[model samples]
Target: MADLKLKDLRYLVALADTRHFGRAAERSFVSQPTLSAQLKKLEDYLGVQLIERAPKRVALTAAGEEIVERARRILEASEEIVELAKGHRDPLAGQLKLALLPTIGPYLLPNVAARLRKQLPRLELMLYEYQTDPMLEKLHSGEIDVGILALPVQMDGLDSYELYKEPFTVAVPTSHKLASRQSIKVDDLAHETLLLLEDGHCLRDQALDICSGADVNEKQNFRGSSLETLRQMVAAGVGITLLPELAGRGAYGAARGVTIRPFVKPVPTRTIGAVWRKSSARREAILALAKLIEAHAL
Candidate 1:
């Protein structure tokens, strides 16, 4: 299989990720026709039908899925080799790919990124935003160097270090009765319909977990895709939702038409941390990033 090319494998992986030819091509920084022609050659060389092409979508065949998995390992190994060869150099000297969950990215990235520029001027940081599921999958596959997200994640081959604990606050429309309260308790949410992030966000799961056994029912048939959207809804007096402490009281705080209140003693909080594959060669850099976040995260 000397005819096999890593470039072609990357095209296939990109196709698998996006499930559309044009999107995959754009992601790979190539034209759609170039990507299509390369994959066709790859399939011919391997004697396997790797993709099932549809009019508007594409999916991997069973063999394609298996090969893509092995291809990811190969790609990650290639990266590790490059990183290892540079071991004598500064660990954070090269381009570092980092991902953050959507909920955390918007609130924390501004400050963190500004500082990363000043602190590691020689390092080029590539940032990406993803939901928890894809973020974890990329971390496991080494598609990203590290991920900053809510902790207590079930990552089998990964380790994480806590950066900070950000408490949850109740956010309601200015006219809501609870808006008059200076503080709230987890139990006080009982009988109130809570607005939460749509499914698949770790923040949503955390809210559900915190509300478990407290008899607080999530609003039926209504789910917000983001904290900002939820805040806008709250401003319009749709319903109430919980927000991270930073979103409530940090420099970016003060969304008009919403009131924020904290939980009393034993405040409900979520641990924020950086996660990376245990085998990552950039452990030192990742830990260094974690330290910076520990200092700046609220």
Candidate 2:
């Protein structure tokens, strides 16, 4: 058998994750044929059949599964070694991949991205927007260095720092009865139908939790895919929805037809935080970013 290559191992791991040649190729940033050929070459070198080919689907052989498991550990360790060296040199000097919840990214990032750029000019910030669960998946898989999301999430093998407690506000159409109010109580939402993001959004769940004491009904016929969509729906006189304080700030939506009002005393809020893998070597970078976010409180 010949010596193993790390890139080939990466290709193999990508295949294992996607279970499709075309998708694996895309994940590996290679052409389908190239990835397939290298995978075949790897199998030949190892003297075993790793992948079972089929017209409709791809399946990994038992040997492929075993090797894929090992490959993942090796890849993680390899990345750790690189991260360790970079941390030693300058923890925040390299590319920092971050994923944020869609509900927060649009509203929050605009407020802090410029600051991050000015403070860590040497660090290249790569940002992505994903809903809560998928973002956590990327963080755990090491595809992203850190994640910004709602706090109290069920995180295993991850460390988190609370950045801010952002209060939730009510967004109602200007013509609605409640629109004239300066502030409303949770009971005001009783028996009201709310436009909300589709499932898989942590915001949706958080909204429901806030109204748990009240009898708030989620609109069944429609679910907004994003906060902007929900805001538009509310503006169209569809129904009221909750918006994080940042989303209601002047820069984000500030919709013409939508009236945003705060809650009365004991305001409902969500704790936003930065999360990273516990084993991550970029502690200094993560902490620095967290500090910046914490400083720019909502």
Tens digits of per-residue lDDT for model 2, 1-298: 5689999999999998898999999998999999999999999999999999999888999999999999999999999999897776987788889888898888887788889889987887899998888988999999999999999887799999999999999999999999999999999998888888888998888999999999988899897988888888898999999999999995766678999999998999999999999999887899999999899856
For all candidates in order, the CA lDDT equals 0.87, 0.91
Off by over 4 Å in 2: 1-88
Error of 1 at 160 (Å): 1.2
Model 1 stretches with alpha carbons more than 4 Å out: 1-88
| Sequence-dependent TM-score of model 1 | 0.69
Q: In lDDT terms, which candidate is top?
A: 2
Worst 10 residues of 1 by lDDT: 246-255
Query: Model 2's lDDT to the true fold?
Result: 0.91
lDDT of 2 at 282: 81
